[model samples]
Target chain A: MPQTASRPMKVSYQDLFWIFFKAGMAFGGGLGILAVLEEELVTRFKVVSREDFLTYYGISRIVPSGSMTALAVAFGYRLGGFWGTIIALTAMVVPAFAITVLLTMFYQVLKNTNLLPWLEVSVLPAALALILAAAIKLGKDVFRPSAGFLLAAGAFAAVSFFKWNPALVLLAGGLLGIILFRSSQGEAK
Target chain B: MSLLSFILLIFTFNLLTFGNGPAMIPMLQADLVDHAQVLSIEQLLYAFAIARVTPGQANVYVASIGYFLFGLSGAFLATLAIQLPGYIMLPFMRTYERMRSNAWVGRFTRGLTVASVGLIFAATFSIGIKTLGEPVTWIVFIVTLLTIVLLKWNQMLGLLLASLLGILLKLLL
Candidate 1:
């Protein structure tokens, strides 16, 4: 029972935008966006409590999209109404968007020079490492020792080997989960 | 490419995406590189590199793509399209709370989560095959893997160091 869910917290749109915008620019990155927000809002500024952040984050994960943006929306709805949702989301997005665009523009300038190629090619392996890290982290969360391993392996094979549509593979996994991993086990599965 | 189809593509990816930015990479790669022929793998990976240099999620890296294809308007539209899913889903979440605890939903989410992880693994395999051939890349790769994954350091630091290493490796052996 987090305090956030029970008692409403008031955050001005100006505060929401500036807080999230600065958080965006801060690049407080060890984990996903939600963790970064927890750091910026809860840990740093004391805007929200730790318990509240985790509570919203948990609910956001359980939601269908499961993206960190969902958590942004959750915070928005909690802190303000529909407009708050828009402003908060915009704050989170604008920095990343602006920087990406500016860099791409700079990339055009770098094109006439020699650094562009190294910058592009040399960075892939590093980027790939990050992607691999993400996979390993997410993999550890979703699969158990034995039974869940098979499900993950099966999904991987379907996508990489068989060239099945990822959407279809996900749909099939959902169907199988309903059929196979029911609540009948009694304990948390 | 038609702007409408491009928007549809962004929307489709967002709708199906279950995790964060990295998890969505393979699906975006499939469409952009293999299916729709919007970008070559190298070009897409370049956008990815530049994207990593920035702060935050860097969601679709479509600004570069949209700019490449259709200029500024395309960039704006693509950014909006990528964001649309989160906004669209927000109202439903606010209005309805029962969807949160349904056991059937729970089962569905478990399946989805596991499969999303698998897709990410497949993505890593595919990208690793194409990249990771050079010594510079190998050094960058190992260092990034150790720092970001093992040490739990911010990816921004890994990327910044990688860029510096790229320059150093170019000047040296």
Candidate 2:
């Protein structure tokens, strides 16, 4: 990895707010945020270099909490330091929070009425299917006909069949991966 | 559940889990639903749907739960609980990078990432068995899965189509 030790461009709090606010509103999911951030932060404004941004993103994935939020923190710190971190994170988070709460209110209105069950019947399967698709995609991406496959499959069985707590499964899987899949490179393949 | 406990629960999970949005779903469900009983599985499914349809982090779904349970204040609390600890730890981003290439950390992260998929699948299966009863739901499920896997459609668009199909099915049948 090429480490660029250059000073960051000075971005105003308002500028950071609107930039990430736009990103927050435009992108719909965690992965999509990367593209939008690249466009706005790297290609468009040149706030952060592609290498640094990607580095932050990689770190974000390894740490706990939401990946996007983690990105916001790192990117924000890169842009403006501690206060920048706060503003950038707020910008990124507030839009989604507002939207979710609005929808929750809508759900509340519909919850007590006869319409709630109907909404559930229609939405739940699609949501489940999306998740199932994600699982399949992840398996295809991760499994290489080795111990990785076995670990993933075993984790699945533990969680699905045995009703094991996911946190515990994840902990055990990490330990197993350490013991079994050592000497491997990172997740990038 | 008390507001403080809710915040503590989300904060604790955020501090611990190594993976991203979908991975947190199962843990959140296990805590808020199975353990706390603050949210029913059905309500949790609806919250998951709302999170799916909306923008930003999927943990916004947990904030939605807080909103549902206690209104705007609850939403703020929950979002803060989940987000603040991670943000505060932003200074440690460099620290994580230092340990990034460590053998054990790499193995742990790989394992955690792979297992997260299974945990997400577990969540999906649990919800699927309970919610996907109607034939129309099955149709939506199949169609959405095919649209995503075969067509390589965008996820937000896929979710929109699924939501519309759900509404249409409810209207038609």
- Candidate 2 versus truth, CA RMSD in Å, comes to 7.3
Candidate 1, residues A118-156: lDDT per residue as tens digits?
654455566667656655644654457654577778988
lDDT tens digits by residue: candidate 2, B2-111: 98888787677766764245666788788878887878887777777776667666677778888867888888988887777557446566664556567667676676
For all the candidates, what are their Cα RMSDs to the real structure? 7.2, 7.3
Lowest-scoring 10 consecutive residues by lDDT in candidate 1 chain B?
B92-101
Q: What is the TM-score of chain A in candidate 2?
A: 0.55
lDDT of 1 at B48: 71
Which stretches of candidate 2 lie above 4 Å from their native place?
A: A1-96, A99-111, A182-189, B1-82, B88-93
Query: What lDDT does the true structure give each of the candidates?
Result: 0.63, 0.68
lDDT of 2 at A97: 91
